[model samples]
Target: MRVKKLLLTLLLAFAALGSVALAEEHKATPAHETAASEEAAYESKSLWKMMTSFYDTTGLKAIIEPQDGVKNGLGQDMSKFSQSWGRVIMFAIIFFLFYLAIARGFEPLLLLPIAFGGLLANIPIANMTGEHGMLGIIYNMGISNEFFPLLIFMGVGAMTDFGPLLSRPKTALLGGAAQFGIFGSLVGAAMLSQYSGFVDFSLKQCSAISIIGGADGPTSIFIASALAPELLGAIAVAAYSYMALVPVIQPPIMKALTTVEERRIVMKTARKVHKLEKLVFPLLVIMMTALVLPDAAPLIGAFALGNFAKESGVVDRLSNEMQNSLINIVTIFLGLGVGSKLAAEQFLVAETMGIMIIGLLAFAAGTAAGVLMAKLMNKFSDEPINPLIGAAGVSAVPMAARVASKVGSEARPGNILLMHAMGPNVAGVIGSAVAAGVLLSIFK
Candidate 1:
């Protein structure tokens, strides 16, 4: 009986071993089969699938593919161009920008290229703005590297005359005062983020948006690129649009702030600025700014170099090239490059509307601050300054200055505040650069 029991136990042990081996085989077979299938699928991928999947969802194929299955038909390919609300709205925005450029002549040079680039960007399947595409190349070369803004600044510096600003050093204060808008807009942005919970703008994004208060497009672009690259298109569009509308925007604010008597108040002629002053000014500014705020060195440095070339009177050829040829070329590329960010996916966001609204407020605040500061100065000083010139301190360059002069002349015919307004106008540029530097230092 004991022998019989031993034989039965041996049989049971062998049967258990066979069951375990069968289970192991079952597990290994599925894994091997899955590996082989995966390899086959990867190898069998169609050219269209391979091409569309190259960059993942960023490619046209990935976006247009149906939820159920891969359809490489023409209809599916063209669907993104028409089916998406973002793309459709972007088309409207692009057309509106074109109308503004061609019909109203609002920033025609920049707007035209921007509109054209936007048009190119919206076309489906072309992938004009993909990694290796033309718009992408332009963006990576100029906007991504932050070279275009500096180039624009160089050209602006070469063309700029600091004589007016140098002659009236005190007017630089207005420029400094106008920067209140930037900081004020910061408060507004933070408040919006805190209270609304609708758009969560970080400190960096707020900084980029607030620079719009400077009313300087390149500065806005530079700050946006450094701090909030995603917001570049909306911030830039708002900055440039408000700048072009300076004629329309500033006049109402100017009339509302100053009395006719204040507007008509004419100041004495500015002292003649010597060439030595002009030559030394750019160098002095560069040295002082570099020593104080090295973070802003890129913008301040480029601007000073351009000014140096212009003022030194030694590099007229280089200066002329920077002011004209170099600037013009960069402007075309810069506009188009900036427009690349205006792609539907990027632009049609809640943050864009916030940027536009806040930008307008910042501009208004800057104008008010400059005017108020000038009024305060008038109370303390013997020199009579037309408070109207304070509005020119937003650094829209000649546009702000021209509006100041126009408004002043309108208040009192023959009262030319162009040259006087120019003092604060140019000063505003320096002030804006300084503000940008300050933000860079803090954030960077």
Candidate 2:
């Protein structure tokens, strides 16, 4: 019986070995045949060469077909141009707009780079619009991860100086007032999301869209990327566009809100802020705002660090490096990543146009809020505050302040609203970040 059993086992082992060998030989037939199949496919190609062909490219065929039936015909899609020309046109338009903005000096600082990135993303291979392209990979790696926004904040921080706000802490109030747009715009976006069947904005999308009123690009990008990544392209474009148009958007609002006397409103010249005051103001702000609203602490922290580095007289090397080289690099990546999110399918919607509109309302509301709040503050203070500076409280930084100066000078030539407006301008930065924190916490 034992001998019989052993012979039976030996026979079974031999059978198994033959089956294995046969399987190996069969695999080799197809594995080796793939090169011929790929060569044939390549030779049959048109003017375009085989570039990063995802399927049957490495002399290998998939062992099995996709089980999901390759949703949305992504399998048959094949990264070709004919089917994706719609996307190409959108990208081309963006490129042309960017060119117009750059060469013609319309928001050239940001629009040019964004336009270039938009073009690169729509090259009709691997569909950077949806997934699995170089731009897509970069977008997921950085923007989706919130790395670009945070790093961009660091750069923005380095460029800012809180000296004006430090000189007159009261300007911080105007900054806080300017954030009225956040709440006001939230109502508008919420209304649109409720009423518009075209494209609905989620709670997160509403919050992300609301920050555009903050008039701070990195903050808008960061919040939107985290909360409403789909809206990144439109939100970013609108944010920067409005920022460039600050001089245009704000002055009209200023004129409407205040009289010539208010436009020409002069305040007591600011006293010299002590060196120690400048040194420690950033630290105190970080501590206070971090405790009060930790959601915005990252943005606030980075900005404060930059300000401290600038004022501290120490770390000159780090300061210079952060301001120029570091910021430039981050800006490039941030711009490109933002552009990658602007796929035709995602951006060419009524909601995109709506976002742009709501963004304008937000800017207008924030400006109005700042101006009215400053005018109100003027009622109580013995030392009058320039109502014009109130408009600078919208976090457009030096741009908003510069606009205040320009407008102020138009009323009374040689009037330097720049220094005065700086106070509220820096304050607006903090206020917008706080608004960002509020939105983040509620939606988080």
Candidate 3:
């Protein structure tokens, strides 16, 4: 009876401990539910915050919000305008360039790349034009250091034939006269800066802008980079835009300045240039540039090297590469590098309008000057020189030459002025390089 009582007491004690433990678990259930609910709420809030942060960083936010303190070249705060409608205007301009490139076929090679680069540059938060960005790297690599323009000059030289210029040396006079527009526009720009109440352009800026008259894109870039980097974007756009519009711009001026008889005039065929003369010409030009105008030696030297390679006949591979592959690659990068400057902050300024107007006048002036010079030369020359060929003196190369030829043919079909016009076309290239050297000597 005593042993049974002891076992019954132990069972009763164990049952009481089990009942206490069950009551404790029942009491903790509400606390566990509260903690689980708190964790789920915290996770849900975190997910919402993440989505909000992502939206804040997107391009839509960047475009919609006005950047507070963007400044223009003149040190004016342009943020209110630039960050608002300026980007939109730039996009429209880029699209216009695209349309010109794709549909109108206006210098598709450079214009297309330029438009794309401008597109990248205008993206607000992406900072594609920042120092570390792709366009920035490209701009620094070639455009900033003045490397790409020289490469472009080299390519032009490789493709150029000096035969026309050599055959009729007097055509060079037309090229020299064409450059009157450069100086004339220089004076005009200086006057505009001084007299115009709205805009202020420094003498250096004027010098850079005036080079647009030459219609040589690389030369304009080279001079602008050295003389007025601030104005490079506007000046380059004006230069190339006018160049691409050569067919459109030159013909009107040629027709306005020349008489029907002058346009109809035809000339004798050009004498073939000796290979030795071709070989000696580039070297002689390089030597003269070195001795007379060392400031131009860099551009002239690269051009001479390309021509030498071509004329030597031994470096066909090198010449071909320079003409084809090297130039094609450099042209793309050059266009992009140039386009980086077309950002709203740089291009949408008041001075850009001035550049466009002056650039157009300068181009018209150059075309008229060339036509008049040709007409004057015709009065004295034994062989009749067509005034239409003078329009090619602006150095748009074969395009300007072709325009002259086309106009001449329209006046008198069967009259081919292509080869004849190339004389001034080639001379204009040399003349523009020389002009750039002069401007650099003065301003740089």
Instruction: Tell me the spans in candidate 3 whose CA falls farther than 4 Å from its real position.
Output: 1-40, 69-78
- lDDT, model 2: 0.77
Clashing pairs in 2: none
**Runs of candidate 2 exceeding 4 Å displacement:** 1-85, 129-132
lDDT string for model 2 (237-307, tens) is: 99998888898899999999999987777667888878898888889989998679988888888888887
Please give, for residues 279-388, the per-residue lDDT of candidate 1 as tens digits. 99989999899789988788888999999999888889999999999999999999989888787767777899899989998999999999998898888878998898
Per-residue lDDT of 297 in model 2:
86
Q: What is the clash count of model 3?
A: 0
Alpha carbon lDDT of each predicted model: 0.83, 0.77, 0.85
The candidate 3 region of ten consecutive residues with least summed lDDT is: 70-79
Top candidate (TM-score): 3
lDDT of 3: 0.85
Writing each residue's lDDT as its tens digit, candidate 3 over 1-444 gives 443454456546745654664564465456556655677678755664565457557654445556677543234465766765677788778877777777777888888888888888777667677777888889889988889999999999999999889889899998988887788899889888889856799989999999999889889999888888878888988888889999888888899888888889979998988999989989999999989899999899999999999999999999999999999999999999888888898889889999998899888888899999999999988898998888889888888899999999999989999999999999998888999899988864
- 1 against 2, candidate with superior lDDT: 1
Root-mean-square deviation of each candidate, in angstroms? 18.5, 16.2, 19.1
